[model samples]
Target: MPLTADLTSADLNEIRQSALGAADPLGVAADLAHSAEAGRLADPQDAGLALSLAAEIAESRSKFDAAQRYADAAVTAYGDRDDSPAAAARALRARILYRSGRADEANALVEPLRPLLTRYPDAAAYVTAALAVGGRARDAERWLTEAVQAVVAERGVTEPADADDAGVLFFLLQQRHRLRHALGLQHDTHDNLAERLETRLANANSGAAAAPATDLVFWPRAEFDRLAERTDAYGATWDEHRASLEQELVRQTAAGRTGLALLPGSVDALTAQAGIGGDPVSPENRAGYARALATGTARIAWPPERNGACWCGSGLKYKKCCLPRSRG
Candidate 1:
C-alpha cells in the first residue's frame, strides 16, 4: 500500500508508538520501513527515520542481520548530513554492528563521531548510548560527562526552550544518573537536578502543570497578507480575529486540552474548502472552523527557530516578532 503524502510528524510518532505496543513490533516496523523505502513519503528524511527506527526494533529483537541492513540503509539515506539526526543514525549503525560481534568495525564507525559530541548534545547522547550498548561502560560515562559539560557551556540544561529541549536534557541527565548508580558512584548535583526535572516533566505530562503562556499558529504568507488588507462584512477586523484565535488557544490550554494548533483561514479559503456558497466570512464562521481543527490528531509545535520566520504570518524573524511578545 502507498503511504499517504499528508502524513505529519505527529502521525509518524503515533505509528511508531503503535508499533512498539503491537504483538509483532518488528513486523510493523519492517512494513513501515518498506513503505518508506518505496519513496512515497513527502519528506525524504522521514524515510531515513523510518529505517533507523526499524533498525532499532530489529536489534532489540536480536535480529542482527536485518537490523544491520536497515541501519546501513538509514546511513545511506542520510547521505553526508552533518545534523544530529544523521549522527543518530550513524550511532545506531555502530551499535548494531557491535551487538552483532563486529566490535572492530563498530569502533571504527563511531570514532569519527567524537567531534559531533561538542557540536550537538542530541548526537553526543546517541553516541554515548551506542558506547553503552557496546559494553564500554567507562568510556560511555566519560563521553556522556563531556556531552553534559558541552551542553551546559553552550545552553544550560536548566533553561529549555520547549518540551523537546526538556526531553533531551531529561534523557542526558537520566542516563548519566543511571550509569553512575550502576557503577557504584556517589550522586552529585547533576543527579539531584535530574530527579527534580523528572518529577516536573512527569507532572507536566500528567496535566498537573501550568499551561503555556502562548502558542503559535501557522500562516501561509499570501493568505495572511490578504486577510491583513481588509475587514470582513461582519465588521470584524483581521487583528481582532487573530486576537480571538490567541484567546481561544489560551482557553483550550486552560481546559487541559493539548495539541491546540491553529492554521487559520480567510473566509474565501474556508468557504471554498468547505464547499459552501460565497457567503461573506463572519467571526462565528472563523471561530467554528478553528475549534474543529483543534481536535485533529496532528499538531504544530510552537516557537519556531529564533532565526526562522514568525508563525504569526509576519515577515520578520520569530525572535524579533512573536517570540518576544510571547515572553513579555
Candidate 2:
C-alpha cells in the first residue's frame, strides 16, 4: 500500500505506542521525521505529535541534545499553526535549555513568549514554559508564584484535571521547591521534585487526565527511587540541624541575647562570612545558590528582620518564608 494509504488511526496509535515504548528515542525520532517528511502523516499536527512524543521519550532517557532537536522540529512543524502545539514546543525548548545549563538563554527566549502564554495561561504547556523561564531567570519568583496560583485556579474550575497536562503541575511544583530552596526557605525535601511527580501521578489516576504508568519502557524507576531516598535523608538532616540551631538560639536568648539587634554592617559581615559579600542577594544569589545547592555543601544566612524581602523579590516576608530555619 502507498504510505499515505497505509496511514490509519490504528497506525497513528501504533506509532504513539512505539514512541512511548522505544528505548532509543533518537532512532524513533529519525523514523518519525522520515515518515513525516514523506507525508505519511495527515498534517502538521501529526508531525508535531510525533516530534513531541520523541522529545518526551528522549527527555525521559536523558538524551537532552536529541530532545532539543526533536522539540525544535516539533515547533517548526507546528509553526504557530496551533496554540497548544506551539506552547508544547516552547515548553520543550525551555526544558532542553535548562537541562543544558543555558538558564539565562532559556529565560531570554521565554520572556518574549510570556505574552503569548497569557492566552493559554491554563494550558499545561504554557504553564510549564512560564514556570521554567521564571525559575531559570532567577528574577521571576513572583511570576512563578503566580503560576502556581494559576494552576490551582485552573484546577478549581476543571474537574479531575487533564492527566496529559499533569507534567506542567509537576514542573511547577519542582520549580516552587527549587525557588524556595534558592531563597533559603524551609521546604520539605523528603520527596523534593518526586513529591510533585507522585502527586501528578495520583491526579492522573484520579482521572484528571490520561497518564501512562511510565514515560517509556525505560522510565528510570531505579534512579527515581534512589533519588527519593536521598531526598529523605537530606530533609531529615536539615530538620535536625534547624532544630538544634533554634534550641541554641533560645538558650542564648534566655541567657540575655534577647534584644538581638542586627546592625547595618552586620548584614555585610554576614554576607562576607557566607563568601557572598558584595553580591546582592537578589538576582545573582538566587541563581548562584540554586546551582551551588545542586552540587551539595552550599549555605546562606541572613537575619530575618534585616532582609525585608526575599532576594528574588517574591514580596514574601524573608524570615517567615525564605530565610533558612527562620521563624519570621
Candidate 3:
C-alpha cells in the first residue's frame, strides 16, 4: 500500500535536513525504514528521501541491481507527484535501466520528462544523464543547455531553495561543463580533470552541497594520480576499469562516474575521496610532478593551459570555449 499519512512540515523538514546532512546514507536508510512502517514517518516524502538516498549510494557503490530497486521504490513512494521530484526519481531509475542494457525502455520512460525539466539543479542533472545514456547524447546536451539556461535566467528570482548550496551552484556550472564538451564547444577550464571530478563528488552527495577540509589542499595532478591508483576496484574487473579509463584521458571527456559529479556530502567526503585526506599540496611533489608532466612522463598532466588553444582544435582560446564553464 502507498504510504498514507501526511507528515507535519516540521517532521518532513527535519527529515530532509538530516538526509541531506548524512555522511553515510546507509544509516539513514535503516533508520527511516524502521520508523516509516509504524507511521512514525508516514509521508510519501519520507519514502522519497529514504529510497532516493539508498539508490544514490547503491549506484555509487556499483550495485546496479540494488540501485534499480531503490530507484523504483522512490518513484513508487512519490505517489504520483508528476512534479520535478517524482520525475527525478524516474530519471534516476532510467539511468540504471540503461546501464542494465534496457536502453530503449530507459529512454522511453524518461524522454517525455525532458520537456518537464525542473528548476532544481539536481533534477536537471539527472534528466540530462538519463538522456545521454539512452543513445541520445546530443539531445541530452541540448536539454541540459536549455535547463541550465532556464535556472540561470532566474538565479536571483525563482531559483529553488537548494540553490544556496555551493554544490548546487557548482552543479549548474558542471552541467554547463558537460554540455560544452558534448557539443564540442570550447572553454578555458576544460583540462582540469581533478577539479572536475572533485566538484562532481561534492555534488553527488544527496544534499544540495561541505565542512572544514578547506584546509586540505591538492594540485590537480595529485588527484589524477590518486584516482589512477584505485585500479583494483573491489567491484570491477581490470578490463571493465580500462574501458572506462579511456574516457579519463582528457578533461573534456565526460563518460563514466556521473554519480560522484554531484555528490551531496560536505568537504569532509570530498577531502577523503578526492583531497588525499585533506593534506595540502607540497612544493617538492608539485615541482617534480610538473617536470614529469612537461616531459610527458607524469601520471597525469595538468589540463591544457587556460590561455592555450581549445583542446578540440577549434582555434579558439580555451577560456572562451570551455574554461569559463567550470566553477574553478
Candidate 4:
C-alpha cells in the first residue's frame, strides 16, 4: 500500500531521517518498505532506493530474511538500467546475501557487475562497500582502481570543471585513501590531492572566505556593444551599470554576502530605468526578478579557468580573449 499518492524523493528522505532521529529502526524499516511498495508505481528508481535503505535497516535489526526480501525487491524495482541506481541495488543485494551466510550467492551476483563499476565511477563506492561486507578487500581494491581510472579519463584535468565533478572525484579519492591506509600501503599523489580537496570543499560548503565563490550573468562584448549603439539610454546605462555593479558586488563580497542576484533587465526596461522613457518597472517586479534569480536562474561562475574557453562564447582562451574586461 502506498503511504501517499504523491511522495517525492525529498519526502522519502525526510521520512527516513525522521525515523532515524527518533531511534526507531523497526519503524524505519516498516515505513520505508511500505513507502517503497507504493513508490514503485510512481518512481521505480526512488522506490528501489527506498527499499535498499529498508534492507539496511532490517539488517541492523538482525532480521536477515526480511533484509534479503527487501534487497531482492529493490533489485527488481531498479530493473536492468546501466546506471548508478541499478548498480547500487545489486550491490546491496549482494551484501545482504553475504551477511546472511550465502557467500557463494553474493559472489556470483556481484562478479558480473564488476564491469558496471568501470563504466560508472559513482557506483564504485557502493560496489566497494558490498565487497568489503563480504570480506573481499582485495577485490574491492581492484575495482576501486578501475573506477578511479574512469574518473581520470572522464575529467581529463586536475581542476574539476564544477562542484559536481569535484564532489565525485573527492569521494572516490577518499575511499581509496581509507582503503590504502587500512592495507598499510603508502600514500600516492591522488591521496594527497584528496586531502587538499577535502579542505577546499569543506571551506566552500561552510561559506568560508578561504574558498571564494560567486555567480554572475554575462553578456558578450559584441552583443552588448550592438545594444549600446541602438540607443543613448543603452549606451549610458551600459557605462553606469557596469561601474555600479562592480562597486556593489565588491561591497557585498566585503560584507561576506557571496550569494546575490543582479537581475538583468530587458532593453525597454533598461531604457526606462535609465529615464529614457517606457513604462517603468515597479519595485515589486524587481523584487520578483531577484527571487526568480535566486531560485532557478542560470548564471555563469565568475572567473573562468585561465586557459579555458571564455564565458563570452569567444573562440579564444579566457586569458587571451576576455579576462581583461572580466571585471566589468
Candidate with maximal TM-score: 4
Per-residue alpha-carbon lDDT of candidate 3 for residues 81-148, written as tens digits (9 for 90 to 100):
86667878888999889889988889788877876763566677788787777676777766766665
Best by lDDT: 1
Give TM per candidate: 0.54, 0.41, 0.43, 0.57
Two-way lDDT contest, 1 vs 3, winner: 1
lDDT of 1 by residue, 1-328 (tens): 2255544456567776766677887786677677678875657668778888888788878898999999999999999887888998999999998888898999998888876766666777678778888988788778767766666667743344333665555567777878876775644545544644564466568867433221233334456556444433211443434443444454456556675465544446555544555332333344355544455444445546789976666778967765554222
Q: Candidate 2: list runs displaced more than 4 Å.
A: 1-20, 101-105, 115-141, 148-328
Q: Which lDDT values do the candidates have, in the order given?
A: 0.65, 0.50, 0.51, 0.63
Task: For residues 145-213, write the lDDT of model 4, one tens digit per residue.
Answer: 777777777877444423455766667777877886677554454654554456446656787753222
Model 3, CA-based lDDT: 0.51
Worst 10 residues of 3 by lDDT: 257-266
Error of 1 at 139 (Å): 0.9
List clashing residue pairs in candidate 2.
Answer: 161-208, 163-208, 163-209
Q: How close is candidate 1 to the true structure, as a TM-score?
A: 0.54
Name the regions of candidate 1 deviating beyond 4 angstroms: 1-8, 155-171, 199-328
* TM-score pick, better of 1 and 2: 1
Better of 3 and 4 by lDDT: 4
